[model samples]
Target: MTALAPSPTLSETTRTTPGAGWLLRLHRPALYLWIGAVAVLAVVLLWLGGPLTDSAATAWREYDKSCDTGGSCRYDQDSIVRYKDVYAYTTAALTALPFVVAAWAGAALFGRELEHGTAQLAWTQNLSPTRWLTTKLIVPAVLVTAGTGLLVALHRVMWTAGDGRIDTADAWYANLTLHANGPTTVAFALTGLAGGALAGVLLRRTLPALTLALACVAALRFLADQLMPHLWPAVTQVTSLADGYRGSGLNVDSGLVTATGAHIADPGCGSTIVAGCKTVYADLDATGFYTTYHPESHYWPLQLTTTALVLAVAAALAVTAFVLLKRSTAAPARVRTEAAA
Candidate 1:
């Protein structure tokens, strides 16, 4: 009766438990739903693509009946319009798909937690905060990147084949342009995910989270495509030589690229090669009709490089969100309660 009970052994106290993957397993129900949706979408897309791609081309050839044959052919307006339509639809699908998937993943990431207040117990579990968040974040991220990259590649093929329509005003501009397909889209997708998470965290309300997420996506994308490209250190078209020849130079519209040296305007000489004289040229690039030339015959390098810079901006935003998530001071349940109140 006087003897005291012995304490439990270390092994008994520390019972075997599941690995870190359990954190990820929580999303299994959502994943199953997503898989079913994707399967259905795949079947539908395959059916749609038949008419849009292979069949459209076949139909065009038959309707035209006689293309410039006998080793000579040229694209007519009808051909250009049809071809552009194919590229436009492909581009629109590609551009919209990223937003669709990213938004959904984003919604899932924070929505479920807020909806059920499950993070309270989840954060207190054996898995460290970093591991828990990482597991949760990374799984959806992988799915998003893979799905987005596949669609983007398809867009690239269509765009390249169509030589890419250049109207930024067009809703499908990003799809056609992101064909450079490097760090830029990486940044874009990450930004989208971060935006979703942030929306979920801040709003604490599902409809608001979705609404704000989409609005932010639109606003952010507009800034990226509309504002960032025009920033300083922007790539410019310049002549290689000092005395470079310009065909149909100087669009009076753009006010940019003003004449530098003395204007040698027609001192009574038509088609006469003036030996030691200078002329100025500039253009707005409107309609791509202002025919000024540049040293770089191809702008692929500039396009890709600038695209990378734009993507970097997105990456920076994502990093900011990640840092905020990691260092959030309040305990999960406490923060949620405070947020809700």
Candidate 2:
């Protein structure tokens, strides 16, 4: 009888098997798409920051000068509208990146493999489930982080270029502009990736996983938006009722301040500018208008705090996914071991 060949050890088998290389090859299309998107967005952002902003600024200057002279105003009106349109589109696209990441990670990255038994097959090939999951998350997380970081930087550059020049430029605290111009968007994207992976592992069905992942991302964003202003202490500006609510930025609260040092909600009217509102304020014993808001100086603080919160959530999701995978795969291994014995 022929001598039996020895079985390969786990370490030897793992060493021979492809890890991220195999993954890259399998998801080549997605990798290409992501790269293409980044390149296109980068080019557009550059254009926006340079030529587009210049043209818009020039047009605004011309319009302002004409108005100052009290002459018939004439300027490149189209340039102003074009700048606004492009700015809106780019900001929207950057804001939507996280949801795209969530959909792909849920449906194609994890759900498809687990749903079709491919993930199990990979595990049997000398790869532990944990290693498999780790590779999946790590590779995508790196790519997502890098791409989003670059895009956010570019977006910030573009936004800054137009900040003081374009009359209609979005304020630093505008929701879409705020997220796109800072690290918070990058954090949101990573959170989306982790949340999606968790959804996929938990559901093991493509459609359901995709749905749940999107829902999770949406909820996270909503909560972040609601919590952003409170992340930093807002500056309180109190102005006489005649001056009205004068502070601007991310408004946390605004109300009427009474002589008794009590704060009461302002009526639907904005300020004492309106005669009716003045009467209302007088009746309420309002001594002044108090506005609490996060000014431009607080932008980074808000962004950083929100980023930290989102990253923490992402970490928790990733850990949960790993633990769930381990428990799910452990039962089958135990059954196999008992049968063999």
Candidate 3:
């Protein structure tokens, strides 16, 4: 009679485990830390939209009435000051969250595994190098994406509520506000994860990977800030000195256009008759001034475009990491084959 196939063993089954449960289990501490940060930010946002907003409104009203009555405005100053401080902190926390995510990903996720012998052990046990790298990337990506998306929702709510209410609230186009208040927040978080993973794979050392990953994140952020305004076309508004233009959102540039069609910088001119205003205008043959800016309507287009750019970079880094892993894994097998021959 033909013999039956041998039964699979526990080690073989564990080696073929296809889920990310083991990866998540290994990085549970970092996951907890991320959750805790999200919790703190959630509470801060709740406070900002609720109690802080209410108190700021009261303080603003009191201060307004005091100005109307020509009385002192110091009574509610404490509340105003406190609200501003808290709002600043909230914005800062939102801006810094991505860096924190990158640090953890670099130091704890792939870095530690490669620094120790655990990665090779896992490979020997049954895990393919590709699957190992994919798990490290995909598991943290899901967690970071979820956490950051929630914070973005809450921040959007807070930002909307602060409109025309909180005196010290940030402008919608302010650098930190623009980034922290949009989908770029989530996009950048994912970018951070991919960047960290790439750095870890390259460095293969925990501390070095952590430092390089953070540096890459900072450089990427700076480039984004510089390129954000140019992602979409800006509207140009030209008018005579009598009827000037005013708008919200990003202000790209403002200057005077001379009669000779030459553009000249604003001379800090408060009036036509100001000390150097007339002279400068005459020299430049100034006729009127023009302002180019992004209106509020451009917010979504700008944000989506920026998100796309960041995601593209993240994808490139991820592809590079996978390619490197494949090469590294293949070299060892080739070496072993040569030795056997």
Local distance difference test scores for all models: 0.48, 0.89, 0.81
lDDT of 2 by residue, 199-313 (tens): 9899999999999889888999999999999988899999998777797799999888998989888877766677687788778888998889998999999999999999999
lDDT of 1 at 256: 24
Winning model by TM-score: 2
Backbone clashes counted, model 1: 0
How many clashes (backbone N, Cα, C below 3 Å) per candidate?
0, 0, 0
Ranking by lDDT: 2, 3, 1
lDDT of 3 by residue, 36-132 (tens): 9999999999888788778888888887778768887555777778778887888888889888878877887778778986777777776888988
Q: Candidate 1: which stretches are off by over 4 Å? A: 1-24, 29-90, 161-186, 227-307, 326-341
* Inter-residue clash pairs, candidate 1: none
lDDT of 1 by residue, 124-181 (tens): 5554445545555667777666666655554445444333222211232343454323
Once fitted onto the true fold, the runs of candidate 3 whose alpha carbons sit more than 4 angstroms away are 1-18, 72-75, 242-245, 267-270
Question: Which candidate should be chosen as best, given lDDT against the real structure?
Answer: 2
